[model samples]
Target: MTQSASPPNRALLELPQVQRERLSHIDFKLYFLGELRRTDVADRFGTGPAAATRDIAQYKELAPENLVLDNTDKIYRPTANFVPLFDHAPQRVLTALSRGFGEGIGEELKPMVRCEFPMALSEPKMSILAPITRAIHRNKAVRVSYTSIESGRSEREIVPIALVNNGIRWHVRAYDRRRKGFRDFVFTRMENPVLLEDSPITDEEKVDQDVQWNRIIELELVPHPAHPRPEVVMMDYGMPDGVLSVKVRAANAGYMLRRSAIDCSPDHSLSGPEYALWLKDPLALYGANNAQLAPGYRNPRDDSENKPIKAL
Candidate 1:
């Protein structure tokens, strides 16, 4: 037996303006207002009277509405009870339009286009998004299976409070049941998250604000000759200086330290040895203060008791 050809995709449907407008009018009536006559809606949508009338009839079949025809005006209007529906219909329509067009785009591109998009396209395998969102809205607890480079794999129940996106990644800040404190779980590392129906953990049990804030670390660096000298050294918050310092806040302090260590490496050619060497006080290296090195300054790898300054 011969196989029948597959149907074409619905995305190929390109109805004319009159038909589209008529369909929208019917949608407005059914979802927002009551019923609207063909001629009246067509006129509002700037279509010819005859076309409007025909569209109205076609739309009525697709989406039925309880519309009444005004004897004097000959126009149809929604019932009094349905009047408030118009207020929210436009926003709903906009949201639908946005969602229809914006599903797979990256978050950075979402702002350029008029739509909401997911943060990452790799389809994070261990996603905590669903459970976390549910927890936030319902005020419940969530059970999560998490994995990390150091921890390997662990299970914990948490009270999700907020979702955060820090440029490169997404995190859920929650009160960890296992740790008995607040912690951030990287969404990409979460697996098999399930929401609990039990009552929400109280705010008194929430993670301490001080502990969260203490996660931040400030590091100062003086440029070595082999390293690249930025046009202007930037420390925290884009503050310019001759020396570079960075303030990194992360749940994983070791990860941040490793990154800082890499950036402070003295092997790069553009940053001479003098600028490449990591200084004890990155802030003090700014301006003329760098001309003199204070006693007790020592390189982590260097074992010499006192070594003379090496030019880049």
Candidate 2:
């Protein structure tokens, strides 16, 4: 009875929900990188030969122009006119090959990629982050036991508004009710959060009121006057004419500059392999709207009107 209801002539796109998603990955690998194999489809879905063959037949029925079987290799190859029905971001494709970190795809689901990249292992646990994610979506307050070098350990309730990645780590941009101000709480430092559904969330406590986060600062940088190999420096950073202009939120400007080893010195005299670039407009990231610098951040522009603050 069930077999009669669902005929063999079902539309390719009308396959069951889970199989459609699996086919999309096949489409992505074939169209984007031209490396889709029957084994890739088999491994991706944990299905044997018969099911994978059926999926391929379904896809071929739907889009015959997109892919053709290579009789020589006994594999499917993308046609010249191939178009992607899945994600096409360059970084997304590159990171998928990085293994274990591609969003939404699991480590067990994907085959091991051949390429290697230096990736840090530090990451927050899903259990600790789940409650915070829900609170952000629901506009609810959460209480967390946070540990920081400055405060040691303490419990506080905060209204989480946004999650920010400051290159190296994730931070929660939340209004700290205990401190009566907005603060950046490192995500990994927070533990065992309790979501407060009844707590009143106000617009004033959201990102709109985060002064440093809202302010944008421009940094004009050129090859360090001290860099002996100026041409190599340009190639190293993929910068043309030896100048790179970057805009960052005022709150994260310090971390970005420090990480890039950009000499913020006026004289551009900071010498070493570290100082391969120097800021052209050294004071561009100073106090926002003429207000004080963000907490714990020291402005090099404030220290020396004539020279850059030392990089050591």
Q: What TM-score do all the candidates reach, one by one?
A: 0.39, 0.70
Residue 174 in candidate 2, Cα distance off native in Å? 1.4
How far in Å is the alpha carbon of 77 misplaced in model 1?
Answer: 43
lDDT of 2 by residue, 234-271 (tens): 89878987788788877677667766677876677667
**Model 2 spans with C-alpha error above 4 angstroms:** 1-33, 38-68, 78-87, 100-112, 119-121, 288-312
lDDT over C-alpha atoms for residue 190 of model 1: 83
lDDT value for model 2: 0.71
Q: What is the lDDT of residue 226 in candidate 1?
A: 45
The local distance difference test score of model 1 is 0.51
Global fold similarity of model 1 (TM-score): 0.39
